[model samples]
Target: MGYFLLSRLLSAAVVVLGVACLVFLLIHFIPGDPVEVILGEGARPADREALRQALGLDRPLLVQLSQFLQGLAQLDLGTSLYSQRPVMELLAERLPATVELALAALLVAILIAFPLGVLAAVRRGTIWDRAASAFALLGVSVPNFWLGPMLILIFSIGLGWFPVSGRAGLSSLVLPALTLGSALAAILSRMVRAALLEVLGEDYIRTAKAKGLSARRVIWWHGLRNALLPLITVLGLQLGALLGGAVITEVVFSWPGIGQLTIESIQRRDYPVVQGCVLLISLTYVAVNTLTDLIYGWADPRVRLGIGE
Candidate 1:
C-alpha cells in the first residue's frame, strides 16, 4: 500500500509538471500580445517598450518559462500582468466559490442518482425502471450551455424562484448547481444501476437473500455496499470534472469563480492569470484522480498490487 501510494504521488507530480510546461508554452503562442492589449495601439513606442519591460514581456520565452517554473517550486504563482496582484491571491479569492459550486453540483447528482438507480435496478422491468432510464438519457443529452439559459428563463425570469446570475446566497446557487449537476446525475445513475445489478447477482447476495434477510437489508447492506466501490471511483473523478465544467456554467451565470476569472484573463490577454488558473485546475484534476486510486486500493486490498506496478 505504501509503495502504491508513493508511485501514484510520483506519477501525479510528473503529470503536473507536464501540464505546467504545456500551459506555459501554449499561452505564449496565442495570437494577441499582452503588452499590446495593455498599452493601446496609439501608445508611443518607448511607452509600450517600457511597459513590456516592466512586465517581463520583453524577456526571451525560455527565460520567462524558467522564471515561472522556479516561482512554482516555491509555491509562488507570480503576479498578474493586468491586475498587478499576486496570481495566487486572485486564485484564493475565487477558489472557494468554484469549490462551493462544484460540491453543490456533486450533492445534487448524488441526491438524484442513488434512489433512482436503486429503484430501477431493484424493479428491473417496470415503469419505474423505464422512467429512471429515460431521465438518465435526457440528462445526458442536454448540454449545459442550453440548459443554463433555459433554466434562467424558467426559474429566474418567468417564475422568479431563483436569481438569474451571480452568487448571493443559497437561492442563487440552485440554478447553476442544477445546470452543472444534471448531466453528472444522469451518468452516475446508470453506473449505479449497473453496478448494483451485477452485485445483486453474486452468490453472496443470493445467500443473503436465502437466509431470509429483509429486502432492504439484502439490497442496501449486501448489494449496495459492494456496489459502492465503483460508485466511489465515479464520484471522485466527477468531482474534478465538475470543477472543469464550472467554466462554462460560471460564464452563463456570471458567477465569480476561478472559471469566470480564467475567461476574463484570456479575453484581456492576462497570461499569468490564465496560466495560474489552468495550472490550478490541472493540479486539482490530477490530485483528485490520485486520491481516487488510493481509495480504490483501500477499499479492495487485492487491487493494491496491481496499482503499485
Candidate 2:
C-alpha cells in the first residue's frame, strides 16, 4: 500500500511539473504583450519599457522560467501582472466558487444518473428504459454552451424562476449546476446502466438471487455495489473534466470562480494569474485521480492485494 501510494504521488508530482512548464511556455509564446494590454497601445515607448522592466518581462525567457519555478518551490505563485496581488491570494478568493460549482454539479449528476441507470438496466427493453436512454442521448448531445443560454432564456428570462447570472445565493447556483451536470449525468447514466447490467449477469449475482434474497436487495446490495467500481472510474475522470468545463459555464453565467478569473487573466495577458490557475486545476485533477485509485483498493480486496504487491 505504501509503495503504491508513493509511486502514485511521485507520478502526480511529475505530471503537475510538466503541466506548469507547458502552461508557462504556451502563455508566454502566445502573441500578446502584457505591457501593451496594461498600458494600452497609445502609451509612450518609455512608459512601456519602464513597466516591462518593473514586471521583469524584459528578462530573458529562461531567466523568467527559472524564477517562476523557484517561486513555485517556495510555495509562492508570484504576483499578478494586472492586480499586483499575490496569485495565491487571488486563487484563495476564487477557488471556493469553482469548488462549490464542481461539487454541486457532481451531486446533481449522481442524483439524476444513478437511479435512471439502474432502472434502465433492470427494465432492459421496456418503454422506461427507452426513455432513459433517450434522455442520456439528449444530455450527451447538447453542449453546455448552447444549454446554458437556452436555460437562461427559458428559466430566467421567460419563466423568471431563477436569476439570469451571478452568484448571490443558492438560487443563483441552480442554473449553472444544471447546465454543467446535464451532460455528465447523461454519460454517467449510460455507464451505470452498462456496468449494472454486466454485474447482474455475474455468478455471484445469480447465487444471491437463488438464495431467496428479494430482487431489490439483490440488485441494490449485490449488483450496485459491484457495479460501483466502474462507476467510480467514470466519476473520477469526469470530475476532472468538470473543472475544465466550468470555465465555459462560468463565462456564460458570469460566475465569480477560478474559471472566470482565468478568462479575465488571459484577456489581460496576466501570466502569473493564468499560470497559477492552470497549475491549480492540474493539481486538482491529479489529486482527484489519486483519490480514485485509493478508493479502487478500498472497494475491492483483490485490488488492495495488487497494490500491496
Candidate 3:
C-alpha cells in the first residue's frame, strides 16, 4: 500500500511539473503578445516599452520561466496581465462556480446512468434495455455547444422554466449541468452496462444465485461491487472530460467559472491567468486520477497487494 501510494504521488508530481512547464512555454510561443494586447496599437513606443519592462516581458524567457516556477513552489500563481490581480485570487473567486457545476454534473451523470445501466444490463434485449441504449446513444451524439443553446432556447426561452444564463441559483445551474453531464452520463451508462453484464456472467454470480441470496442483493451487492472498478475508472477519466466540457457549457450559459475565465484570458492574451487556469485544470486531472487509484486499492485488495508484493 505504501509503495503504491508513493508511486502514484511521484507520478502525479512529475505530471504536474511537466504540465506547468509545457503550458508556460506554449503560451509564450503563441502568436500575439500580451504586452500588445495590454497596450493599444496607438500607444507610444516609449509607453509600451515601459509597460513591458514593468510587466517583466522585457526579461529573457528563461528568467520568466524560472520566476514562474519558483512562485509555483510557494503556491503563487502570479498576477493577471489584464486585471493586474493575483492569478490565484482570480481563480479562487471563480473556482467555486466551476466546482459546483462539475459536481452537479457528476451527480446528474451518476444518478441517471447507474440505474439505467443496471436495468439495461439485467434486461438485456428487453424494451427497457433498448430504451436505455437509445438514450445513451442520443446523449453521446449531442455536443455541448449545440445542446447548451438548444436547452436554453427550449427550457429558458420557450418554457421559461429556467433562467437564461448566469449562476443565479439552482435553477440557473440546471441547464449547464445537464449540458455538461449528458455526454458523460451517456458514456458512463454504456460502460456500467458492459461492466455489470460481464460481471453477471462470472462463476461467482451463479454461486450467489445458488446460495439463494435475493436477486437484488446478488446483483447490487455482488455484481455491482465487482463492476465498480471499471465504472470508477471511467468516472475518473471522464472528470477531465467534464472540465473540458465545462469550458463550452459555461460559455454558453455565461457561468462565472474558471472555464469562462480561461476563454476570456485567452482572448485578451492574459498569459498569467491562462497559464494558471490550464495548470489548475491539469493539477485537478492528476489529483482525480490519483484518488481513483487509491479508490482502486481500497475497492480491490489485490491491487495494493500486487503492487506491494
Instruction: Give the best candidate by TM-score.
Output: 1
Give the TM-scores of the predictions, in the order they appear: 0.97, 0.96, 0.95
The RMSD (Cα, Å) of candidate 2 is 1.8
Q: What lDDT tens digits, residue by residue, belong to model 3 across residues 161-244?
A: 999999998999999999999999999999999999999999999999999999999989999999998888899988976876
How large an RMSD does model 1 have?
A: 1.4
Strongest candidate by lDDT = 1
Residue pair clashes in candidate 2:
none
Clashes of each: 0, 0, 0
lDDT at residue 112 of model 1 (Cα atoms): 97
Candidate number that wins on lDDT, 2 or 3: 2
Over 1-309, each residue of candidate 2 has an lDDT whose tens digit, in order, gives 777677778888898889889989998998999999999999999999999999999999999999999999999999999989999999999999999999999999999999999999999999989999999999999999999999999999999999999999999999999999999999999999999999999999999988999999999999999889888989999999899999999999999999999999999999999999989988888889988988886777777577456
User: Can you rank all candidates by lDDT, best first?
Assistant: 1, 2, 3
Please identify model 2 stretches exceeding 4 Å from their true place: 301-309
lDDT score at residue 139, model 2, on the 0-100 scale: 98
lDDT of 3: 0.92
**CA lDDT of each candidate?**
0.95, 0.94, 0.92
RMSD of each: 1.4, 1.8, 1.8
For model 2, the run of ten residues with the poorest summed lDDT: 300-309
TM-score for predicted model 3 compared with the true structure: 0.95
